[model samples]
Target: MWKRLLGFDPATMKVRTEILAGITTFLTMSYILAVNPAILSLTGMDKGAVFTATAVSSIIATLIMALWAKLPFALAPGMGLNAFFAFTVCLGMGNSWEFALTAVLIEGILFILLTLSNLREAIVNAIPMSLKNAIGAGIGLFIAFIGLQNAGIITSNDSTLVSLGNITSSSPLLALIGIVIVSVLLIRKVKGALLIGILVTTLIGIPMGVTNYRGILDWPPSVAPTFFKFDFSGIFTPQMGLTVFTLLFLDMFDTIGTLVGVSTRAGMMKDGKIPNAKQAFMADAVGTTLGAMLGTSTVSTYVESSSGVAQGGRSGMTALTVAAGFIIALLFSPLFLSIPGAATCPVLVLVGLFMLSPIKDIDLDDYSESIPSFICIITIPMAYSISDGIVLGLISYVLINLLCGKRKKLTLPMYIMALLFTLKYIL
Candidate 1:
C-alpha cells in the first residue's frame, strides 16, 4: 500500500532510507515548534497555547502533504508570517491577535480559490527565471539573517543598522559551537547531520546552564485561548483588509517559490513543470486555512523540506515519518520547547546556504536581469519582508525593461501586476 500510494519501488528507496529521510526532515524543521511561540508571544498571546497550536497544526498539515500531495514536504506556521503577525499587525499596528488571525484565514481561503482556478500556476509561470532564482537566494539571506538574530550573533545598533553581538555572550558562544559541530558532521557526510547538530549543541548547552530540565511528560497546553478565536468583524475595516492582503501576498509568492526551488532540486520538475502540481498547491492552501483556525499563523511548505529530499526522500513515506514526529512532539513539549535558539541557529544558516546555491545558475552578465535580481536579493532582508522585496523587484523589472527599450520582453500580466503594486502604495 505504501509503495503504490507513493509510487516508489523498494529497490529504489528502501523503508530505512525513507524513515531516515523523514527523521532528518522533521529535525531540520522542528525548530518551528519552539520559534513560533516565542515570536507570537510578543503579541500578548499565550505562549503555551501557541506551542500546542503550532505542533497540532503542523502534524495535521504535514499529514495532508504526505497523504494527499504525496510529497516529502512538511508544513508549519511560517517564520516570516509569524513575525508579521506578531510584530507588524499586533504590536506595530496595535491590532488584536484575533484580527490578525482573521486576515490569515481569509488569505488561506483566497489561496485555495486561486489554486482551484489554476491561477496560481499561471503566476508561477509568469515570473522570469532570473527573478525566481533571485527570490530563492533572497529568501536564503533572509533565513540566515533570522538565524543570526535568533542566536544573538547579530543585534541592533543605534549607529549602524546591525552590528556584531558580544561574542563572549552565552548565546553567541553556544551558536558558534553549534555551527562548528554541524559543519564538521556535514563534512563527514553523516546521516541526519542537521538533527545531530541540534541535539549535540543542545547537550553542550546543558553544562553552560542554558538547557534547563523541566522534567518530561508534562501535559500539553490547551488551545482554548486561541482556538477558533478569529474576529471576522474586523475583516471589513481598511487596516484589517490591508493586513489580509499583506498576508495573502507574502504567502502566495513564498510558498510558490519554495515549491519551485525544492522541486527543481529533488528532480520532481520535468520541463519546468511539477508533477501533481495541483495537489501540492492545495496541500499548502489547506494547511494555512487549518493553521489559522487552530490559532497559529500561516502554515506553508517549509524550505527545510529540501534537507529531507537531500537525504534521499522521494515519496510520501518520508513525510509520513515527519508527521509521526510531530505527534510525538506533543507529549514531549517541555523537551522540544526547551531547545534554545542558539542550538538550532546553525541549521537555519546552513539551510540558508542550501537555498542560495541556485544563484550560481543565474545569468549575471546581463545587467538588466542582474540589477533587478540584485534588488530582490538585497531588499528581502533589508525591508524584513519577502513581499516587499518581490514587489520592488517586479516594479523595477518593469521600469528597467521599459527604459532599456525592452518593453516587449514582459507579458501583459507583468505590466498589470506592476500597475497594481504601484497603486497599492498610492491608494
Candidate 2:
C-alpha cells in the first residue's frame, strides 16, 4: 500500500530519514508563512487571514504533490509571485485586491489549459534562455528592494527619488543584524537558516522594542476575509489580460525551474526529462487554482525542496511529511503573524541572491541576448512592474533581432508575444 500510494518501498522504508527530510524542507521554506502574509497584506487583506490562507494552501498543494505527482517537492505561495501580486498588481496598478485575485484565478485556469496542451512548452520555448534567466534575476532584485524599503534601509527622498535611510535607527539596525545572522547561517550550511534568522531577529528585536511580543499558539485564523473574493468586473480589460499573463508567466517558469533544479540534484530526471513532468505541472496548476480560491498568490514548487532531496528523500513520503508540518504550523498564527517585517527582510535579501544565480548561466557575449536580458533585469525593479519588464523585454528581443538581420532566431510564438505586447501599449 505504501509503495502504491507514495512510492515507498517497504524494503527501503527509511521512515526516519523521510520524516527528517520533510521537516527540514518545511523549516527551510516555512519563512513564507510569515513573509507571504506580510507581502499580501499590503493590499489590505487581513494579515491573520492571509497567514491562514498561506498555511492551508501550502498544506493542500504539498499534499497534491505527494499523492498525485508522487514527488518530494513541496509547494507554497511563491516569493516573487507574491511580491508581484502585492506591489505590481494591487499597489502599483491601483487595483483592488479583489481584482488581483480575479487575475490570479484567470492565470490559474490558463495554466491548467496550457499544461493540458502542447502550447505550454511552445510558450516556454518561445522566450529566449537569457530572458528567462533575467526574469528570475529581475524579480530577485525587485523583492530585495521591497525588503530594504520594509526595513527602512531604503527610504523615499524627495530630491533624489530614493536614498539610504539612517542605518543606526532601531528597525534598520536590527535588519542589518538580521542580514548578517542569516548570511552567517547560510554560510555554515545550516538547515532552515532563513526561518531561524527570522526567529532570532524577532527575539533580538524584543529588547530593542522593535518586535512586539505576541503569544504563540492560537486557533487557526479564519480565511473568510480573503477566500472566494474574486472580482470579475474588469475581466475583459487589457490590464486584466496583462496581469493574468504576467502571473501565469511567473508561476510557470518558477515551477519548472525549481522542478528541474531539484530533480537534477535528486537524480530524479531520466533521459533529460522529469519522470512525471506532466503530472508535476498539473500539481502546480491545480495548486494555483485552488490557492486563488482560498485567497493567496500563485503556489509553486519550492527550490528549497532540494534540501529534502539532499537528505535522501526520494519519494512522496517526504512531501507528505511537509504537508503534515504545515498542518501543525496552522496553529501558530499568532507567532507567524507577529513576525515583524524587519524579521523577514534578510530572507527576502537572501532569496534575491538565490534567484540571481541563474544569471551566471546567461551568455554575455551575445549582445542581442544580453541587451534584452539586461533591460528586463533593470526594468523590473526600476519600473516597479514585473509585467512591464516582461513586456518591454519581449518587444525589445523581437525588434533587436529583426533589425539586426537575426530574425531566424525569433520563433513564431516569440513574434506573436511581441505583437501582443505592442498592441497592449497601442490599444
Candidate 3:
C-alpha cells in the first residue's frame, strides 16, 4: 500500500530515496501551516480559528493532489493571497471576515468553470515561454522580499523605496546566520539542507532571545477548537463579489503557472496536455472555497514542493507526507509558535533562488517574449505584488506581439486579458 501510495516501483529506486524525498518536501513547505495563521491574525481574525482553518485546508488540498491529481506536489494557503486577505480584503475594504470568505467562494466557482471550459489552456499557451520563466523568477523575488521583511532585515526609509536593517540586531543577525548556514549546505549538495538550516536556526535562537521576544510562546491555558463555523451572510453582494473575483482570478493564474512549470519538470505533461489539469484546478477551487468556509485565506499549490520532486519524489505519497506533517503541526501549535521568523526566512529565500534557475533557458531574441519577460522579472519585487507583475507582463506581451507583426498570434482571449489588466492598472 505504501509503495502504491508513494508511486514507487519495486523495480526502481530504493525505499530510502522515496522516504527522503517525502521528508524533504514536508520540511521545506511546513512553514505554511504556521505562516498562514500569522498573516491572517493581522486581519483581526481569531488566531485559533485561523490556525484550524489552515491545517484543515492544507490537509484537504494535499489529499486532493495525492488521490486525484496523483502528482508529486503539496498544497497550502498561498503567500500573496494571504497578504491580499489581510491588507486588501480585510483592512483596505473594511469588510468582515465573513464577507471576505464569501468572495473566496464566488471566485472558486469561476475557477472551476474556467478549468472545465478549458480556457486555462488558452491562457497558458498565450504566455510566451520566457514570460513563464519570468513569472517563476518574479514569484521567487516576491518570496524573498517577504522573508527579508518578516525577519526585520529590510525596512522602509524616509527618502528611499527601502533600506536594509542593521545586521547587528538580534533578528537580522539570526536571519543572516540561518541564510549562511543554508547556503553553505546547499553548496555542499546536501539534501534537506533548507530544513536543516531552519532547525538549527531555531535551536540557536533559543539562547539568542528570539522565542521570548514575540510573546507567542506564552500561551493561554486552553483554547478550544473552532471548526465548521462558516458565515456566508455577505456573499453575492455587489462589493464583496468583486473583491472575491479579484482574489479568485489572482489565485487561479498563480496556481496555473506553478502547476505548469512544476508539472513540466516532473514529466507530467505530454504534447502540451497536463494530465488531470481540470481535476487539479477543480480541487484548487474547492480547496479555496473550503478554506474560506473554514475561516482562512485562499489555498493553492506550493511551488517549493518542486525541490522535493528534484529529489526524486515521483508520486502522491510525498503530498500525503506533507499533509500528515501539517496535521501534526496543528496539534502542536505552541511548538510551531516558538519558531521565530528568522528560522523560516532562510528556507523561503533559498527556495526563491531555486525558482530563478529557469531564466537561463529562455530565448531573449524574440521581442514578444523578451519585453514581457523583463517586465515580469523586475516588477514583482519592485512593485511588491505578483499579480501586478503578471498583469504588466501580459499586457506588454500582447502589445509587443502586435508591434512585431505577429498579431496573428494574438487570440481574442489574450486581447481581453490585456484590456482587463490595463483597466486594473487604470482603476
Candidate 4:
C-alpha cells in the first residue's frame, strides 16, 4: 500500500532509506519548533499556541509536498519570514499580530493565482541555465554559512563582519568534532553518515555540557489562543501594499531558490527544468494559506530539506517520513529539542559541500554567464540571502547582455524580472 501510494521502488529508494532521510530532514530543521515561537511571542502572542501552530502547519505542508509533488522536500513557517513578521510587520509597522496574519493570507492567495497562471514557471524558465546552476551552487554556500553560524563555528566581528569563533568554546568545538566524524564516515562511504554524525555529536556533547538530556515525552500545547485568529477587517487598510508585496516576493523567490538548490543536489533537475514544478508551487501556496489561518507566519519550503536529499531521499516517501516526524514531535518536543545545534550543524555543513558539486557544470567560458553567476555564488553567503543573490544575478544578466550586443539573448520576461528586482531595490 505504501509503495503504491508513494510510487517507491526498492531498486531506486529503499523503505529504510526514505525513512532515515525523513528523520534526518526533521533533525536538521526541528529547531524551528522552538525558534519560531520565541521570535513571534515578542509580539504578545501565546508561545505555546504558536508552537502548536508551527508543528501542525509543518505537518500539513510536508504531507502536501510528499503526496502532491512526490518530492523529498519539507515545509514550515519560514525562519526569515517569521522574523519579518515579528520585527517588521508586527513591531516595526506597529500592526497587530492578527492583521499581520491577514497579510500573509493575502500573499498566499496571490501566490496561488500566480502559480495557476503559469507566471511562476515562466519566471523560472526565463532564468538562464547559468543562473540556475549558479543558484544551486550559491545555495550550497548559503546553507554552509547557516550551519557554521548556528554552531558558533563562525562569529560576528566588529571589523571583518564575520570571523572565526574561539575553537575552544564547547559548542564550536563539538561541532568541529562532528564535522570531522561526518567527514570520515562519508570518506568511508558509510550509509546514514550525516544522521550518525548528528546523534553521536549530541551524545559526545552531553559530557562537554553543550547538550542536555531533556525528558523524552511531553503533551502538546493547545492552539486555542491563536487558532482562527485573524484581523480580516484591516487587510485592505492603506499602506499595506509594500508589506504585502514584500511577503509575496520573498516567499516566491525563497521557494524557487530552495527548489532549484535541493533539486540540483538530488539530480532531480533535467534539461533545465524542475519536474512537477506546478505541484511544488502548489504545495507552498497551500501551506502558506493554511498556515496563516492556523496563526503562524508564512509557511514555505525549507532549505534544510537539502539534508534529506543528501541522505539519499529521492521520493515523496522521504517527505512522508518528515511529516510523520512532525506529528510525533508534538508528543516528544523535549526529546527533539534536546538535540542541540552543535549536533545537527554538521549535517548542514556536509550537505552544503554536497550541493556545491553542481558548480562543476556551470559555464565558466562565457564571461556574460560566468560573471553574473560568479556574483551570485559569492554574494549569497556574504549578503546572507539566497533571493538577493539570485536577484542581483538576474539584474546583472539583463544589463550585461544588453550592453554586450547580446540584447537578443535577453527575453521579454528576463527584462521584466530585471526591472522588477531593480524596483525591489529602489522602492
Candidate 5:
C-alpha cells in the first residue's frame, strides 16, 4: 500500500518518507472524524452515539475508498452536508434526529440508485464547465467564510450581509496572525505548511488565553459504542421522503464538485469522465447510509482530501492511510477533542485558499458562463449554502443563455437542471 501511494517500492522507501506521508494524510482528514460527531451533537443526539456513528461511518467510507474507488481520496461526513444536516434538516425543518437519520439513509439509497442508473453522469455532464469552476471557487469561499466566522473575524449583520469583526478582539487577531502566517508559508511553496501554521496559531492562542486547555489535561473518558440504530419509521412519509431526497441531492452535487476539482488536479479525468465515478458514488452512498444507521449525518468525500494529493499522494494508499488514522483516533476521541476549533480553523482557511487557485483560469468573456460563474463563486460564502449557490447559478445560467441567443446550446439535461432549480425555488 505504501509503495502504491508513494510510487516507491515499499522495500526501498526511506522509513521517514513513508511515515511522513502517512502522517500528512492523517492530519489532513482527522478533522472530519472529530468535526462530524461534534456537529451532530448539536442536534441533541446522544453524544456517545454520535461519536460511535462518526467512527463507524468513517471506517466504512475509508474501506470503500480503499477497496472500491482505489483512489488517493478520503471520504467522510462533508462539511457542507453537516451544516445542512444541522441547520436545514434538523433545526430548520423541525425534524427529529431519528427522522433526519432516516432521511440520510433514504438519500444514500437514492444516491446509489442514481449512480447505477446513469443519472449521476447525466447531471454531471449537464453542468457547464465554467459553472464547475465557479462551484470549486465558491466552495472554497464558503469554507473560508466558515473559518472566519468560527474565529470571530466575521459576523452576520441583519441577515443581508456579513461584516468584519473587531480587530481588537483576541480571537480575530489570532486568526489574522494564522491567516497571514499560513498564506506566507503557502506562497513560499512549503510542504506541510498548513499543518505548521495551524500548530503555531494554536500554540499562540494558548498563550493568549484564546484556547482552552482543560480538555488536554483531562484524560478522555471511554464511551461505549452504540451501533446500528436505523430508524426508518418516519422516513417513508411523503414530506419526509422529499426532505431526504433534497438532502441527498444537495450532498451529491457537493461531492460531485469536490471530486471534479480533486480529480482534475490529480489528472484523474479521461475524456471528461472520472474513472470509477459510479463506484465512487456508490461508496459515498453506502457510506452515508451506513453513517445514518450508525447515528451520524451523511458521509461523503471531503474536498480537503485534495490536500493529500497536493502533498504528493497518488493512489488509494493515501486514503487508506487517512482511514487507518481515523480508526485509531476513534479509539482516542478525547485526544482529538483536545484540539480546539482555533487550531483547526487555520487549516480550514488555508485549505480554502489552496482550493481557490483554479479561479484564475475560468473564462470570463462569455456572459453565459461568466455571469453564472461569478454568481456561483460569490454566493457560496455570502449565501452560506452550497446548494443555494448551485441552484441560483443554474437558474442564472439558463436565463443568461436564453438572453445571449445561445438557447441552442441548452442540452436536455441542462434544461432539466434549470427546471429543477425553478421547481426548487417554487417549493
Candidate 6:
C-alpha cells in the first residue's frame, strides 16, 4: 500500500527516515505559512483567509508531487514571486490585488501549456553538467545566506550592503547555539539530527524569550475572502501581458533551479536528467493554478526541500509527509508558527553545507565551463536571486563559448535560452 501510494521502496527507503525527513522539511518551511500571508496581506487581503489559502494550496500541490510526480519536494506560494505580486503588480502598478491574482491565473494556465509541450523540461535538460553542479553549490550559498539573515546573524548595511549582526543578541545567539548543537549531533552521526536540533533550539528559545509560544489549537480561517477572487477586466491589457510574462519568467527558472539543484544534491539525477520531469512540472503548474484560484501568489517547488533530501528523504513518502504536515498546520498553526526563525535557521545553514559538497566535481581547468559555473556560484547569493544567477550564467556561457569558437559545445536550447535571457534584460 505504501509503495503504491508514495513510491516507497522497502529495500532502499525506510518509513521512519521518510517521516523524519518530511518533518524536518516542514519545520524549516513552516515559516512560509506565516510569511506568505504577512506579505500578501499588505495588499489588503484578509490575513487569516490568506493563511488558510496558503496551507490548502500547499497541501494540494505537495500532494500532487507525492502521488504523481513522486519526488521529495514541496511547493508553496514562493517568496520572491509573492513580493512581485504584492509590491510590483499591485502596489507599484496601481492594480488591485484581484487584478494581480488574475495575472497569476493566466501565468499558471500558460505554465500548464508550456509543461505539456515539454518546454520546461527541455530547459532543465539543456543546462550543461558543469552549470548543474555549480547550481547545486550556488543554491547552498543562497540558502545559507537566507538562514543567516533570517536569524539576524547577518544584518543590512547602508554603505556596504550587508554586514554581520551582533552575535551576542538574542536571535543570533540562539541560532549560533543551535548550529553548534546540530553540528555536534551530526558529528556523532545521530539520526534525525536536523529535526531534533530545530525542536531543541525552539525549546531553548522559549527560555531565552526568543520564541513566543502561542496557544496550540484553533479553528482554521475561512478561505472565502480570497477564494476564486480573481478579476479579469484588466486581463487583455499590455500591462497584464507584462505582468503574466514576469510571473512566468520568475516561476519557471526558480522552479527549474530548485528542481535541478535539489535533484543534483540528492543524487536523483539519472544520465544528467531529472526523473519524472514531466510529472514534476505538472505538479508545479497545478500548484500555481490552484494557489492563484485560492487567493495566493505563484507556487513553485521550494529550495527548502533540500533539507528533507539531506535527511535521507529518497521517495515520495517524504513529500507525502510534508502534505500531511500542512494538513495539520491548517488547524494547529499556532503550534507550528511558534517555532521561531532562529530555531529552523540553523538547519538551513547546515543543509547549505550539504548542498555545497558538489562543488568539488567541477573541473577548474576548463575556463569556458568553469567561468560560467563560477559566475552562477557567486551570483546566487551575491545577487540574492536564483533566476538572476542562472540567467547571467547561461548568457555568459553561450557568449563565451561562441567567442572562443567552441560552438560544438552549445545546444540549440542553449542558444535559444541565451537569446531569451538577453531579451529579458534588453526589454
Top-lDDT structure, candidate number: 6
Model 2 per-residue lDDT tens digits across residues 292-341: 99899999888667656655788899999999988988986566456677
Q: Higher-lDDT candidate among 3 and 6?
A: 6
- In angstroms, the error of model 3 at 384 is 2.5
Write the residue-wise lDDT of candidate 6 on 1-427 in tens digits.
Answer: 8888778899899999999999999889999999999999999999999999899999999999999988999998999999999999989999999999999889999999999999999999999998999999999999999999999999999999999999999999999999999999999999999999999999999999999999899989998999999888887899999999999999999999999999999999999999998998999899999998999999999999999999999889999999999999998999999999899889999999999988888988989999999999999999889999899999999999999999999999999999989999998
TM-score of each: 0.90, 0.73, 0.86, 0.98, 0.86, 0.99
Ranking by TM-score: 6, 4, 1, 3, 5, 2
What order do candidates take by lDDT, descending?
A: 6, 4, 1, 2, 3, 5
Candidate 4's displacement at residue 10, Å, is 3.6
Better of 3 and 4 by lDDT: 4
Which lDDT values do the candidates have, in the order given? 0.83, 0.81, 0.74, 0.89, 0.72, 0.94
Clashes of each: 0, 0, 0, 0, 0, 0
Give the worst 10-residue stretch by lDDT in candidate 5.
216-225
| lDDT (C-alpha) at residue 165 in model 5 | 81
Write one digit per residue (lDDT tens) for candidate 5, span 1-427. 6444334445533444333444555665566656766777787777766766676677788777766776667777777688878888778888767777777878888888888898887677677777777777787777667777878888877875778889678888888888888789878978667667767887888878886654423222233343555567675577687787678777877778777767765556666677677777887889988787777788887776665665656556666677777777766666655455556566667667766876766777766788888998888778776777777888899888988889887788888888887987788
Q: List the pairs of residues colliding in candidate 5.
A: none
In model 5, which runs have C-alpha deviations exceeding 4 angstroms? 1-35, 42-44, 83-94, 214-226, 265-267
Worst 10 residues of 2 by lDDT: 264-273
- Give the Cα RMSD of candidate 4: 1.2
Candidate 2: segments with Cα more than 4 A from true spot: 1-51, 66-107, 186-196, 223-281, 295-322
Per-residue lDDT of 304-342 in model 4, one digit per residue for the tens?
999988988988899999999999999999999899888
- Identify the runs in model 4 with alpha carbons over 4 angstroms from their true place: 1-4
